[model samples]
Target: MADPAGLPPRLRPSTVPPPAAVTRALHAINTCTSAAALAPLRVHILREPALLRSTAVISAFFLACGRLRSLDPALVLFASLPRPHVFVFNSLLRSLPQAPACSPLPLLRHFLGLGARPNRYTFPLMLTSLSSLRELNVAHSQVAKSGFARDLHVRNALLARYAACDPDLGHAEQLFDEMPRPDVVSWTTVITAYRNHGHSFLALATFRRMFAASVAPNRVTMVSALGACAAHGAVDTGIWIHQYVQKLGWELDVVLGTALVDMYGKCGHVAEGVRVFSKMTERNVFTWNSIIGAFALVQDGEMALRWFFRMKADGIRPDAVTLICVLYACVHAGLVDIGRKIFNLIVQGEYGFQPGIKHFGCMVDLLSRSGHLNDAFRVVEAMPSQPNAVIWGLLLRGCKDHGDSVLSEHVTMQLLELEPENASHYVTLANLYAETGRWLEAHEVLKWMKEKGLAKDAGWSLRMLEDRSSKCISDGNFMECAL
Candidate 1:
């Protein structure tokens, strides 16, 4: 009879452990594609005491477990073996990360308990399993003590943990500076660290240094560089990067392609973004979102809607983010009817997404921009979560534009109540009153502002916020921030 691993009864481990039979069984174990395929193999390994002695056999089984994320069987196998080799322990350690729920700490302790010394490769693998700051520091100290701190693989892993995961870039930057020779991964990680931590210019500077040092940036590195360019509206830099990538003949895969699309869109070069999108041979949901976002930036609602349908046609299910892009596109083109329908898709569970704050904000902006003041206000009230100041503020802008003075006063009072100390809300209230020819009330609000030491900063409370936050498609109009 054949086992779940498709190991025939003939290939099953025998007590004698024939060399040819064992080799065939080992091949089957190595090629295991699923947990069901590995389960019976585990039973055979446990039954045949002779097979348990071969570290090669044990390591292959553990690797299969890692591949299938079946760590429990590997743990059982590890427990059965006496005096397991360091390679066997390392194999289990390598698999530890693949099993999402398993923690590596206990296994590391086991490795230490068995007096098994971890090699240079072991430190890198071990470092990836550490999450907390204290755990990371302790692991690094152990690496230094073990004399593998100078190892490039160990160094890159530590650098990545600090740069990519942790917010503390001080040590990450320090690690990069101290590295005797930082490779592309090292450079890419440092660049990513700076870009992610709000240091856009610093990230680009690191990229330039990486470029000058002749360490060629890979696709991941380019993604970080493009992101920095997008944040600072450095389209010229982004264009140069795109040309450089083209010159290098690198494939515009989904990730790199999405970064380029977002960059060009944020810089108000949607045409360039569309061209990049058309050139790409492969795309994912993120790629679709970026292209749609580019159209949203240009206020090209029709194009955005067309790409939205095409994304569905391509069989990529729309995520919550995709909905946000399309909804914002509706806001840009004042397509209230279309925006309402798209928002309904979420409420109807068509996309299986509960609308989030960002989604509600987009809808509010759409209704507000289209002069559906009451509907926008109703959405704010009906949303699951409490309406944030942005929604109230968006509605207030609509009221002001449509000259609904009564609605404006109501919104203004709500804003004042929510943000009692915000000078802009006070300024808005005063401006509304003055514009209504109610000089007394305007002066009274301004007087009250002075009493509270709230200086009425003109045109900044909301406008400056929109400037920094809504770097949405060219002209930096108010829209949600890009990915």
Candidate 2:
């Protein structure tokens, strides 16, 4: 008989220990720095009946196996047992997620085959593996059938899983509603779900409900609430959260501080964002990104550039997002020489990596908007990846704005090839022809569009004075636009 593919002829399948013995078992496992060192310990632990029986001991064993990329040994020990402990099964289920492609379903089947039952704690770990809405539905049913549906921890896991995998929050909300006494984790899960799924108002509403229920918001809960406030431009709500944080005497950590700064930045309160940044005792790359992005939002490129340097001076390495934000700052402020300097650093891999498409896009925007159309054209041509329609479209619009009819026609041809079905590109080219007094070319372009049954979206976007959002007729929805 051939050995199982992954099992080296023999295999057994497999947190913190509460007991001193369990703790010692974990320590024994942890002390092994390498697989060779772990091998002796693995042999001892697998043979120790007492260690295999303890929940934490076995869980740590699997974690050790996972850490060493040696789950096969854990599997061998697990399979060798005629009737493994429930904790042993649960441990394997939890740790298998680390392997990603390894599913715990086979272990589950074997456990059930041994006539062993999974408890409430077991289902939560199992649900972590669910990757699709269908899988979530199936797990929820299993949770119900196994009589663990009412278990709060299990239900919270299910709620999180649903939020992650489901298209909408309807199912997650149902789970939240059915919870008898939802705790901070429960409320936070739902609040975050609402915020993530573009229901900022509902997220805020859920936050309010969580507040009214007398469940004190944790740092995590407050962060999600602030995110909702940011999305909807509810600066007032953000202010309230800021004040509440102050009242609570909670010092601003990197994550909480970043979220607060980002909320203020997105809401157009640059000074407040700066004040928050100054108050932060420690700032990571993300925190710096937020404050710099705040400056970018307000088109204060010089200030953005100042902070960008300050971040590096403070020993924080700027990430790709930070560079993107700073580049956009240059684009908005039309700081051509400054933008070019930064783009050069990107091209030379000064930041430890070559420029990606987004960096190139920002550089192109900076050059084009600064009326350096030919230079922008060269950058696009030199891009490692194929230029998408958006890149071409930006250059085309730049050509029109600068009255470069010749370059505009060339850019439009690229756009036409890239997005053949897009009628707006056709219309733009026709409009450009007419603008340049090429009436015959304009008429011919329009005629070709007509022959292709293509029509430009009438009233592409209706700009409203009271609302910056344009009610786009093309998509039948309002999208934010500033002119």
Candidate 3:
């Protein structure tokens, strides 16, 4: 018997004509959390003459229930409404995007049929569900036809749609530069598209260009550039960016701070990573993961474990990423028992978190490093399903570690079947054969790899430069890259 519309007392519309019906419908829409409430609300509106005709009342109801449960009711209500206008169609189209289950194509068809020109809001929402470039190009054409091209918001959304669908960043750049004056979102979208396409240098250049144009970068711009710096191991540039962030008094932002830590960590500045991490006022799961990984990468597994325990004690739940980093720590520290314990925790602990391929790979590495080749094989054999290339690759590497020729051969065959083009598989198997002085067999394996046109990789060097003054150089052995 409570008023079905659950408007807060302060927000309740006082001057509205049908207060009780409005209040009840609003409550049903806003307060309704389940399908049962939605069913009754639908019946109530249909039965109530006053509520049936008010667009404001119906729109409020749909907005309150959100898109998932409101679609069918919206359609029913649209059919019954005496004058369903363009705004009504727009509302329905907007709702279609809220749920991944509902396809936007039907809504697009309906909108076109109504001859309703898609306003600025329409294409952006429609672009979200688009899966292919062809559909996106169609949407892009519609935007031009509607003359929203010069509208910055619509253009920015178009840039985003292109950035998302187009593998090449050319269209993104063109769209970005064509804007009369690109705003921060425009610049950020362009930079992000380049960064995502593995053009880190280009992303960094864009940021500089934005700055050179007297356009100030926002938090998103700085964060994205910092990510590119991190990936490329440009520590000096990263540090300069960090200083800029601090000077602007934005260093306290958790997102930006976390990126700084990750950048420093990946650049081989572990101490700097720890320093940035310590200064963070707010630590997220990613923050913990970065610091732990930094320690693990530096072979300071003890510190990684320390942080892992601290993370749990701090009441932040560990996710698969957290576990993966901790498992790597166990691998580095040669803590087979600890690795097994962590593996069991993931597989059967109170959280009952499912183990991913990386987790299983860590387990295999741990077991193999401990001279437990058969146990490593057992772990692979006991997997819930067939193993992936990583699992088989790890097992093969473990066999190499323990000089187990038979198991190595078996794993090599499996790896070849899983990833036939992987040159390293043949190389690993060849190395195992050579260990037993089976030179001919080893040479044959290498010959087969060459014959298959799988090119073996050579070692590479990474030189990160910061201006002409500061540089940090690091070289990685091929083992890590090969795996």
Give the C-alpha miss distance for residue 373 in model 2, angstroms: 0.5
- Clashing pairs in model 2, backbone N/Cα/C closer than 3 A: 11-76, 12-74, 12-75, 12-76, 12-77, 12-78, 13-75, 13-78, 13-79
Instruction: Provide the lDDT at 121 for model 3.
Output: 77
| lDDT tens per residue, model 2, 1-483 | 456685456544533336676667788877656766656666776677777576667667777776776777778767866787777788777666533566665677677788888997888888787687776787788778778888888989998988887777778888889898999999999999989999999999999999899999999999999999999999999999999999999999999999999999999998999899899998889889989999999999999999999988988887889899999999999899999999899788888878888888899888888899999999999998899988987887788789898999899889889988887777777666555545455556666766787754413421121122112222333222211
Candidate 3 residue-wise lDDT, 38-149, digit = tens: 6567778889887877666677655544544546666566556655455555566556543346566666666666655667777776777676677767777877877877
lDDT of 2: 0.81
Model 3: residue 57 alpha-carbon error in angstroms: 2.5
Q: Which candidate wins on TM-score?
A: 2
Which residue pairs in model 3 clash with each other? 5-23, 5-24, 5-27, 6-27
Decide which is better by TM-score, 1 or 2.
2
lDDT of each: 0.82, 0.81, 0.75
TM-score of 2: 0.82
lDDT of 2 at 74: 78
lDDT for model 1, please. 0.82
| Cα error, candidate 1, residue 64 (Å) | 7.7
29-95 per-residue lDDT for model 1 (tens digits):
9777879877799889888766777788898899888878778889887876767788888888787
TM-score of each: 0.74, 0.82, 0.80
